[model samples]
Target chain A: MSSKTANPVMRSAAWRISLWATLAFACGTMVVFAFLHRFVASDIRQRTDAWLTGEVEVLGDVAEHTPKDALYDRVVSEVAELASNEVPNRLRSEGHSNDLVFFLQTDAQGALTLWVGAGRGEAYLDAIRRRPFKPDEPQDLPVAGSDAPYRVVALHIDDGSIIYLGLSEHDELRVLRNLRFRFFTWWLLLVMLGFVIVFYTTRRMLSHVREITEAASRIGHTELDKRVPVSARNDEVAHLARTLNHMLDRIENSVRQLHTMTDALAHDLRSPLTAIRGKLEMSLSAAAHGEQAEPIVAAIDELDRLTEFLNTSLDVAEGKADALRLSKSELDLEELLRGMADLYEPSMHEKNLRVRLTARGPVRMLADAALMHRMISNLFDNELKHLPAGCTVEFVLETAQEQAKLTVQDDGPGFSQEILPHLFERRVKGKQSSGHGLGLAFVDAVVRAHGGSVAASNRKDGGARLELVMPRGLAAENAEPRPVIIAIAGSGKP
Target chain B: MRLLLVEDELEIQTLLRNSLQEAGYEVDVAGDARHAEQLAMESAHDILIVDLGLPDRDGISLILSLREMGVSAPVLILSARRSVDDRVKGLEQGGDDYLTKPFAMAELLARLRNLLKRNTPATGEPTRLHVQDLELDLLRREATRSGQTLQLTPQEFVLLEYLCRNAGRVVTRSMILDKVWGMRIQPDTNVVDVHIYRLRGKVDGKGQPPLIRTLRGVGYVLKDR
Candidate 1:
C-alpha cells in the first residue's frame, strides 16, 4: 500500500534511466545541429564572395579595354547585367526585377562615374567611400537604405578608376533561416520519439523485476513454500528469482529439520519424565499418611520443576533462533492486564504487599495469547518472589504512537548492580535468586519475537521498573488466519 | 464407568491403568492405534484417554476416524508436545480435553472426571443450588449459609458457583481458572489458595464444620459431612 501511494514514477528506476538518456540524446543532437548550421552559412557566404570577385575583375578588364565614350558605358553596363542574371535563382522570389546584385564605377576624384542596380547606387558608393577598400578583395558593407549587408569586391582599372561589384546577402540569410527552421522541427520530433522509446523499453524490461518483488513480499514465514514467479526469459531478473527460491528452499529445509529435532527431543525426554512422575504419584497416593508420602511429593515437585525448566529452555532457544511459531489472535491488553492483576492480588496480599493497576480503556493488538499470558505471568512471579514485604507493585497499560506500552514498577530492592547489564541474557540472575534465571530471558524472547522491545532498569528511588512497547496490528499482517474448530460435545458449560 | 486408554509406552500405560482402576473405573488398554480402534468398536465406553504418540498412526488421525465411526464419547488427549499450537490442533481434531505429558496423576484424574461430567447432561435447569446449609440463588446471583446472608463479589460468586456445581469432586486450580476466570495458562502463584481461604472463612462460620478442604499440592473439594 505504501508503495502504491508514494511517488512511484520518480522512484522507479525505469523512469530515471529513460529521462537521463533522453536528456543526453537531446543535448548531443543540438550540438551537431549547431555545427551544421555554422558550416552551411559560411559555405554560402564564400560562394557569394567568389562570384563577386570574378565579376568585378572581368568588369574592370572590360572598362580598361573599351574607349572612354557612351558605347564603353553601354558595354560595361550590359556585361554587369548579364553577370548579375547569372547568379543562382533557386530561392529567389518571383516578380522581383532586381537581380539582388549591384555594379558601380568610381573615378579618381571619388565621384560615381556609372551605376547599374535596383536601388540608387549613391548609398552603396557612399558606404564604400566611408571605409577605404582594398582592391580585388570582397568585403561586407552595409548601405544606408538596405536591411541586408552587401558583399562588395573592388578592382582598379588602367584609367585611374575603380570598379565595384556588390552582391546582397538577403538570399544567403533566407537560406540559412529556412535551414534552421526545418532542422528545429525535425529535432523536436526526434527528441520526443527518443524519450518515448527509452521509457517504454526500460519499463518493459523492468516489469518482471517488479513482479518478483511483489510476489516475494507476499510470502510470510508460515508460507515459506510459496515462491516468486520467475519469468521464462533467461535474463538477470530470472537469475535473481532463482537464487531467491534456492535460498528459501534451504531455509524451509532447516526449519523443518528444527521442528523435527525439537519434536523428537521433547518426545524422547518427556516420556521418561512422565513415567517417573506417574510412579512417584502412585506411591504417594498409596502411602497417604506417612513420611514416605512427603518425600514422594517432594520428588514429584522436583520433577515438575525439571519439566518446567525443559520447556522454557526449548522455548528460549527457539526464540533466540528466530524460529518461534506464533498463533496470532486479536486481544485486549487492558483486559489481560486486569485479569493478571486480579490473579495476583491475593498472593500479593499474603506477602503484605500492595498492588495497583492503572489503565485507560482498552488497547487492542494482534499477538499470541498463550505467549502473552506466560510473559506477563513471569513478570508477576518475579515481583512476588523478590519484592520485600510492605512494598507496592504498580502496573500501567496505555497506547502511545500506535504502540502498546506496559510498565511494571515495584518499590523493592532493585536488581543487583553486577547482574543488571546481563539481566535479559539467558541464565543471568542475582546471587540470592533461586530461579533457573530464564524468566526474564523468556520474557525478552517473547517480546522480541513479536517485533517489540523491552527494557529493565532500576528506578533512582530504589525500585525496579520494566517497560515494554509492542507495535499494534503487526502480527496480523505476518500471520495467516487459522480456521477455528470448536468441539461439539464440549461446547456447553459443565 | 468404562474407559479406554491408547498409549504406546508400556510403563505409562500400566501406571495410568492402575491409577484409573484404583479410582474405581474399568479401563481397557491398547498399545497402538489399530488395537485401540478394535477395542473401541467392540464395546461402548464412557470416555477415551488417548496418547498422541501412537506407534501405528498419529493420535489425531485415530480420533478423526473414531469420530467418523460414530464414536461420540468425549476424548482426552495426552501428549508430550506442550506448545499451544499442538494443544489447539489436538482439540480441533475432536479431542474434548488436552493434558501435556509429565503431568501429575491428580491432574490427569481431575481432567478425566471433568471430561466425564461434560459428557453427561444435567437433568434440568435449577434456579438454586443447595449444599449442606449453603444456598445459591442463581437467578439473583446471591449466596447464603446457615440462613445468614454472605457478602461476595461477582467474581467470588462465580467461583463459589463452580465449586458448588462439582461439590463432591476435586477441582484443581487450573480447572477453576479455566472454568471461573476463563484463564488457560496457570500462573505460578498461590492466588487460588488465598481465594479458597477467604471463601472458606465466609462459608463455614466459627462453629460450623469446615466445608472446604485443601489437599496440599493437589486441589480443593467441597464435601457436606
Candidate 2:
C-alpha cells in the first residue's frame, strides 16, 4: 500500500478529485446555513421588539385613562417589583421577559422620576442615560459593563414623561452562535462523506481500466488465444473489452490461414521436385556407358542445387513474413563457433583454404541456436564457394562495449564493386555461383531478429569482410568484481 | 534385403523401386497408407521407407500403427515438410531416421544400408572391424591399416567408421554430413571431401593399394579388390 501511494500521479489524482468535490459541497452547505441563520436572527429580533412595544403601549394607556393617584400607584408598584428581581405586575400579565429590559419614565415636571431595573438592567439604564433618547426611531446603545448592545425604543407618554424600552441583543447573538456551531459540525461530516464517495467511485472505475492494460501486456504472438474477459455491465469498459476480443480473433485467424497456406504450398512444390530428381538418378545409373549418362548426371546435380535453393528461399520468405518460430536460448559464442569450424575443417582443407578461429574467452549471447548455426554455416559456405585455392578464412569473436562482435574475413578477391553495397540483398550472387543468392540475406534476417545487425564490406587489404554485432545477454555490469587474495606465509602450515 | 517403399506419387514410386531393386534389395511399392499397412503386416521386410503425405492417412500415423502391430522393421520417414518440428515429431513417433524430399539417391541408399547393418544379429562378433588391409577397434576408437596404427582425429574416426560400415556402397556427402556432423543437409561446401582426403592419406599408406574410391558427382565408395 505504501509503495502504491508513493507514485505522485496516483496520489495527487485521488486527492485532487476528492478535495475539490468536498470543497464545492462544503461551500454549498455554508450558503444554506447562512440563509437559515439570517431568518432565525430576524425572527428573534421582531419578537423582542413586539414584546417591548406592547409593554410601552399598556403603560401609556394606563397613564391616559386612570386618575393620577391610581396611575402613580401602579407605576410605583411596578418599579418596586422590578427592583426586587420579580416580574412587574403589569408586564407579567402579557408574559414579557423583563430580565434584561430597562423601563425609564419621567413625570410632567421634566425630572427623572422612574429608573427601575436591576443587575443587567442597571447597565442598560446607565447606557440610556448617557445618550439622548429619540422617540420616533429605535436606537442601538452599548451597555456599560456588557458586550451586548441594546435596542432602545423611546416614546413620549401623556403623563409628560418620556419612556425608553431597551432590549439586550445578547440573547439573539447567543442563539445565532449556537445555530452556527451546529451547522459547522454538520458541514464537517458532509465534507468527509463527499471525499469518501468520490474516492471510491474513481478507484473502482480505474481498476477496470487496469485489468484491460494487464491483459494487453500478456498477449503475444504465441498466446493469441487469450482474451480480455468481458464484463456484464453494458458500459464503456465492457464495450472496449468486446472490441479488443474481436480484434484478437481476426489476428489469430489470419495467422492460422497464412501458416496453413505456406505449408500446403511447400508440400506441393517439393513432391514433383523429389520425383524428378529420383528419375534423373535412375537414368544416370541405367545409361550403361553412353552419351546419355553425361547429361543425366548433369541434370541430377542441377536438381540437387535446385532443392537447396528452394529450401533457403523458403527460409528467407518465412523470415521476412515474421513467421519463423525461433526457440531462443543463451549460447556460448566460442563453443558454437568452434563446433562450426570443426565441422568445416575438412571442406576447408579440400579447397586449400586455411580456417582460423580467434576468441576472447566465452562470449555469451541470447539467440536461436539452430538459426545462428545456419547463419554461421552460410557465411563459411559463401567464402569456400567463392574464394580460390590458397586463401585463408578468419573468424574473430570479441566484445565491444556491451555488444558481442563476430567478424568473418577472407584473404581473397573482395566483393566486386557492383555487389559490395548490395551484398546482403536477396538473389544477389556472383557470376560463377551455384547458389540462389539468399545466403547473406538469411544471415541478415537471423541477426536482425536477434536484435543484432550484420554488415558486409570489402577489406582494404583485398578481402571480403562481414561483421555481426549482437547485445550481450547477461547482466555482467552489476556483478561485483572478484576480490584479490594475498597469501599469508605459513598460514596453512601453522 | 527386403524393403517396403510407401509413396503416393507414381513416378517417385517407380524410380525408387527401380533404384532400390537394382541395388540388390527386394523392393515392394505401396501407393497409400492402407496398402502400406497391409504390406507391412504381411511381409517381414528389413526396412520401411514411408512418405509423410499419403492419400488415405499420414505417414506418421501409419508408422505408429505398424509399431502397435509389433512390426519391428526400421522405419525411415520421407517428407517434404522440412521444418525441424516435423522432423522431430517423425523421429519421436517410432521412426529410426528422417530424410526430407528431393534427397540424393546415394544418401537414401547409404542410410538404408546402415540401418540394415545395425539390425543384423551378430554371430561370434568381435570389437574390431576389418576391410581388406584396414582394421578398426570399436572400443579404443583406433584405426590400423596392415598392422600400422593410423593417427586419426575423433571426426576422422567417425567418418572412417561410417565408410567402413557401408564398405562397398556409395555414401553421398549428405549422408556423411548427416552421420558424422549430425547435420541434415549442407550445400556448396567441400567439408566432406576434405575430411575424406585427410582420412585417405592415413588409411592408404606407402605401397598400399587404394581402398577408397570417389564416385565423382555421386559420393565415395570403399571396397577391397
Candidate 3:
C-alpha cells in the first residue's frame, strides 16, 4: 500500500489484530501437531525398531537361507561398493541420515557382527562389544543438548539371545523445522488481515470520541444549542451524544437567563443615575447653592426610583421575581381597582379624559395585594403614557365563574408596532426615552408570577386596551381589603 | 468646625472640601485608613468623615481603631454599596453613622452635623441659637421669629430642629430620609418638597424673614444673621 493512502494493513490496529490472530491459529495447530507427533510418529518409529531388531535376530537364520560365507559374499557384492567409500558429489547425503545401527547376535555365535548404516562409525561396535545384545524391552537415553526425541528397542530371539535397534531423532526434527517455516509465512498473512479489520473498527470509534470532545470545546465559545451528533446504532457513543446534547440545552437556558439579568441591571441603574444627574444639573443651573427645596424634591424622586428598581431587581433575580411577596391576606379586587381609579381621577381630569370604573360584588382574590395593585397600576400608567392626551380612559373589573377580568381602555393609540416586539424584554424597552419601560415588564412579570395573564391591544373604538385575567381558585371567601391611597410614583405604574 | 476626611477618590475629596469650605469649615483630607487614624489622633477635629475601601486596611475597622485609641470624634462611613447587611455591619463595628457614596455634598454635611451633635459634649445647654431672624428656644422647646411664636407640626418641628442644629450648613434629601423617616423613601415622589413647602408657611409665614433658604442641588439650611 502507498503511504499516502489510508490502508488498514499498514496501521497499528491492523498489525496488532493480525498478530493476535496468527498467534491463536499457530498455537491451535501446534497443539494438534504435538499430540500427533507424540502418538502416530512415535508408534511408527517403535515398530520400525522392532522390525529391525527381528531382522537382526534372523542373522542366525541366514545360515538356513544360504551358507554364512556365501551370504556374506552376496551382501558385500551388493552393498560394499556403495558403502565402503565416501562419494564426493551428490544432491543429498547418500549415507543413511538417521538410520539405526543394526547388530546380529545368536548365542554369541553368529558371524555377522554389527552392520551400521553407511555413515556409521566405531561407536556402535564399541557399544556392542560390551554387551552383544540388549534385553527384551525398549530403553530411553537422555541425549543431552539434542532438540529431537527418540527411543531404542531391543528384541529377544528364540535362541536365548537378543538383537537391538537404534533410532535417531532426525525425521521428527525435520518435521518440526518444516512446520516452523510454514507457521511464519501464514502468521505474516493473518497479521495483515487482522490489522485491516481492527484498524477500521478502532478508527471509527476514535472519530466518534473525537467529535464529542470537539463539541464540548465548541459549546463554550459558540451557540449552546449546537449538539454532538450520535452514531446510527444505540451504543456507548450514542449515549454520550444524547448526554452532551442535554447538557447543551441546559447551558443555553442558563445563558439566556444571564442575558436577561444583565439587561435588568442596566435598566435599574440607569434610572437612578439619570435622576441624580438631572437633579444635580438642574440645581447647578438654577444657582441655588443652599437649602433649595427643588433639589430635595428631585433627589427624593431619584432615591425612590433607585430603591424601587433595586428591590424589584433583587426579587426577580432570586426567582421570587414576583414584586411584593404574595400577601395572602384576602383582598377585595373591586375595592383595590376602585382606589386605583380614584387616584388617577385627578390626572384624568387634567388630561380631559373621562375614567369610568365599574366594580362588581365583593369579588375577593388571594394574591400579592401590593404586587397585584402594582400590576393594575402599571396597566393604567401604560395608557396614560403611551396614549396621546385628551382621550377617555376606561377601567373596569368583573368576576364571572370564579375568574376575574380587569380591563383598562383609552381612546388614544396603542403601542407603536416597533415597541410591541420587545415590550417585555427588560431594559430593551427604551426606559430613558420612555419612562422606566420596566413598568410593563414589571407588570408582565408580576402577573405571570400570580398565575394571571395580561394582554394589550387596540380597542375597537380607536384606543388602547389592556386586560388582566386572573383565576380566583386561591382566594378565601368574604375577606375584605381596606381602602388606602397607594402612592403612584410619578415615574411609573407605582 | 474643622473636619478630617478619609477618602480615596479625588473627585469625592474635592466635593467634600468644596462643600465643607463653602459651609465654613476648615477641612483636612486623608487618602487611607491609616492616615485617617493618624490625622484623627494628631489633630482635634469637630467631625470625621471616612470612606470604606481604603488602599491600606478596611475602613470599618479603622473606626474601631480610632475609638480604641480614645479618638471619640464621631466617624461617619460613606460607602458606595448601600446593602442593608453592610450598613448594619458598619454601625455595629463602632461607626457612628453610615451613608452610601455618590451622595450629594448636602447629604454628607447633614450627616456630619448629626454625628457631631450626637457626640458633642454638653458643656452647657445650647439654649439660644439664631439663624437670621429665626430663634429656637431649646430649653422651652419653642421656636420664634422676632419674638413672635410660630406654629409647627411635629415633622415641621423636627425639620426645624435639624436645620437649627446645623445653621449655615447644607443638608441633602438622603440625610432627611435617613434621619427624619428612619426609612429610605423612594426617589420618585415630591413628598419631601410637599413637607418643606408646608413647613415654610409655618416657620416663615409671618413675613418677618425667610429663615429657611433653599440651596438648589444641595439641601435646606438656616443662616445666622
Candidate 4:
C-alpha cells in the first residue's frame, strides 16, 4: 500500500476492540492463576504439617516408654531412625538422602541432649531454640545452610524433655513451581488464540462495511439510478445498505419528476410563444414596406428576447440545483478561445475595441462543449456590451496545478460599487446595461455544476476581471458521445 | 415545392401552415403522428417538418415509420425541446436538420431550402465558385473580387465559401456557426454579424458595389446581381 493510503489496521475499530479484549482476558486469567497458586501452596503446607506433627508425637511416645538408662538412648535413637526412614526419599541421589529430615531432643532446661541425622542438626539448633515450642505444633524454621526453609514440630513427654522433627520445604516448592510453569504456558497460548479469533471475526464483519462504502462512493450524479450493493445477511450493515438504497430510490424519483415537470413546462410555454412569433412573422411579410411593419418587427424581437430569458432562467435554476444535464467531452480551451476571438473581432472593431488572447499551450479538460462555448461567449458578450470604445479586452488561458484557468480582463470602468457585492446574482446589472442579467448567474451555475469555481473582481489598475478555474480531470469518461448524422448527398429525392 | 407539417398544438399548426404556404410551398398539415403517417404514405413530399410533441405518438417514431416505408424526402425536425441531446437524437433518427421552436420563419425557410438543395446530387466537385465579380478558387483556397485578390484568413475564407454556396438565399447566424465553424450550440452574441461585416469589407472594398445584404432580425443574403 502507498504511504498516503489509509492504514486500515490502525483505523479500523476491529483493531482496538481485539486488543482491549485480549488485555482484559490476560489480566483476568492472571488473577485466577494467582489465587489458584496461593490455594495449592497452602494446602501442600498443611499436609506436610500433619505428617510432621504425627511423626513428632510418635517419637515422644517412644521416649516416654524407655527407661532412664544407657539402653534408653540406643532404643530411642533406633526408633527415631526408623521413623525418619518413613519420610519417603524425595532426593534423586543417595548422597543427600538423610538431608531431608533431622531429629533433635532437648531437656527441660532447653539444652540439646540428643541429635540425629544430617550432621547432628547443628545449623538448625539455634533457630529451633530461639522459639518457644507448643506441643504437637509445627513451625517454619529458616536453617542457616539451606535456601529452603524447614518445617519443625515438637512434642513434650512426662519428664519434660522435648522431641523435635524438621522436614525440608524444597519438595513443596518444586511442586508449586511445576504447577505455576504449566499454567503460565497454557495461559499465554489461550490469550494469543483469543486475540486472533477476535481480530479476524471483527475484521470479517467490517469488510462488508468497507465494500458498501466503496460502492456508495462510485455512484455519481449522472448515474443516480445506480445503488450500493446490499448483502443478504440480516445484520446492521445490511440494514444500513437497504436504507441507503431506499434514499437513492427517493432521490432518483424526485429528479425524474423535476425533469418531467421542466419538460412539460418547456412544451407548454414554448408552444404559445412559437405561435405568437409565427403569426407576427406572417403579418410582417404581408405588410412588407408598410407603416405597420416596424412595430411588428419590434414585437418579434421582444418575443425572441423573452424566449432567451426563459431559456437562461431555466438553465440557471437547473445549474443551481445541480440538476443540469451534461454531455461531457474533452475540449481544448486555447483552441476554443482563439476561434471565439476571431468570430468576435469584427464587432469589437466596430466599437474600436481591441482583444488580445494569451495562452501557454493547449489546456485540455473534460466538460460539456456546448455549455463551455456558450459560457465563454457570454463573457465576450459582456465585454462587448459593457466596455467603452477603444478599451481592450484580454483573454488568458493557462493550466495551473491540474486546473484550467481562463481569465477575461477588460480595461474599462469597473462594475458599479453598489452592484459589486451581488455581481453574479440574478438580475443584478449595471444601470446602463440592457440585458436580462442572467448571464453571469448562468456562468456561475455552469462553473459550479462542473465542479469548478468562478470569481469576479476589479483589478487594482482599474478593470473588470473574471476568472474561471475548471479541474482538468473529470471522471466522466464513460459518458457516451452523441452520434453525428452526416447528410448523404443523393439519398433523398431531387 | 411540397411540405408536410406535423404539430400537435392547433395554433402552432395553423400558423406554420399559413407561413409555409406564404413561402410558396404546397403545405399539408397533421395534428398527430397517425395523420402524418397517413398523409406521408398517400403522396410524395419534397420536404417534411415534424414536431416531436404529437398527440398519438412521438414524431420521432413517425419519421422512422416514414423512412422504413421508403419515403425518401428530407425531414426537418421542429420541436420545443432545445437541448443539444434532443437535437442530436432527432438528426440521428432520420432528420436532415433540427430547429428548436419559437424559431424565426426565415431560419426555417432557409433550412428547408438547404435540405432540398442537399437532396439533389451534384455532377462533380467544382474547382471554383463565382457570384458576380467575386470568385473563389476552391482548390487553392483563394478568393478574388473584381480582379483584385482578397486577403482572407482561413476562417474567413470558409465563412465566405458557405455564404457563396447559398448565394441569393438567406442563411442565419446559426447556420454559419454550424457549417463553417462546426459549432453545435449557437452563441448568444453577434459573432456571426461581425465575421460577416469583416468579410464584406474585404470582398467589397472601397468604390465597390456590395453584394451582401442583411435582413434585420433574420440573417444575411449574398445577392447574385
TM-score for chain A in each prediction: 0.78, 0.52, 0.42, 0.66
lDDT per residue for candidate 4 within B1-225, as digits (tens), equals 989998888988888887788779999988888888889889999999989888788777788788899988998887897465554465645438888888877779888887888888757878999999999999899999988899998889998898898899878777788788766555556678878887888888999888888766567889998
Name the best candidate (by TM-score). Answer: 1
| lDDT tens per residue, model 1, A1-494 | 22675478778897799989999999999999899989988888778877887888788888899898879889988999888876753364654435478889989887999999887888888899899899877889998878889888889887788889888887888888888899889989998898889988888878878887878876656467899888898988899999989988998888777877887788899999999988887776678656767777678667777887888778788788667777888888778877777777777777877777776666689898878888888888888888888888888776765688889898899988898889888999888788889999999888887878889999999899999989876433322223222111111211
CA error at residue B169 for candidate 1, angstroms: 2.6
| Per-residue lDDT of candidate 4, residues A1-494 (tens digit) | 12434577867788889999999999999998899999988888888887888888888888888887888778877877777666642445445646777888888887887887777555677988777878777888888878788888888878988878888887778778889899989999999999999988888777788888888866656678899888999999999999999998987888777777777788788989999988887787678664678788778778877887887787887787777777888888778887777677777777778888877666678888888887887888889899998788888776766777888898899888899889878999999998889889889988887888898999999999999988877442332233222111111212
Question: Residue A70 of candidate 1: its Cα lDDT?
Answer: 75
Candidate order, DockQ descending = 4, 1, 2, 3
Worst 10 residues of 1 chain A by lDDT: A485-494
Give the top-scoring candidate (lDDT).
Answer: 1
Give a tens-digit lDDT track for model 2, residues A142-199: 8777677877777787657776666667666777787888888878887888888997
- Candidate 3: give its CA RMSD in angstroms: 21.0
Q: At residue A38, give the lDDT of candidate 1.
A: 91
Interface RMSD of each: 1.9, 2.2, 7.4, 2.2
| Model 3: number of backbone collisions | 20
How accurate locally is residue A114 in candidate 2, as Cα lDDT from 0 to 100? 60
Q: Write the per-residue lDDT of candidate 2 for residues B18-134, one digit (tens) a residue.
A: 888888989989999899878888878889899888989988888878888988889778888756565445464543877788787888887786577667775665788899988
lDDT of 4 at A61: 80
Alpha-carbon runs more than 4 Å astray in model 2: A1-219, A223-245, A287-294, A327-334, A346-370, A385-424, A429-434, A448-494, B41-46, B67-72, B84-95, B113-127, B138-141
Q: Which candidate achieves the best DockQ against the true structure?
A: 4
Better of 2 and 3 by lDDT: 2
What does candidate 3's lDDT look like per residue over B1-225, in tens digits? 888888886655665676678778899999998788778878888888877668788777887778788877777776644232344455746548776544565666666766777775657766787776778777676888777788864556677887787677666665664566443433333345555666787787754567777765456777765
Per-prediction DockQ comes to: 0.59, 0.50, 0.06, 0.61
Order of candidate numbers by lDDT, starting with the best: 1, 4, 2, 3
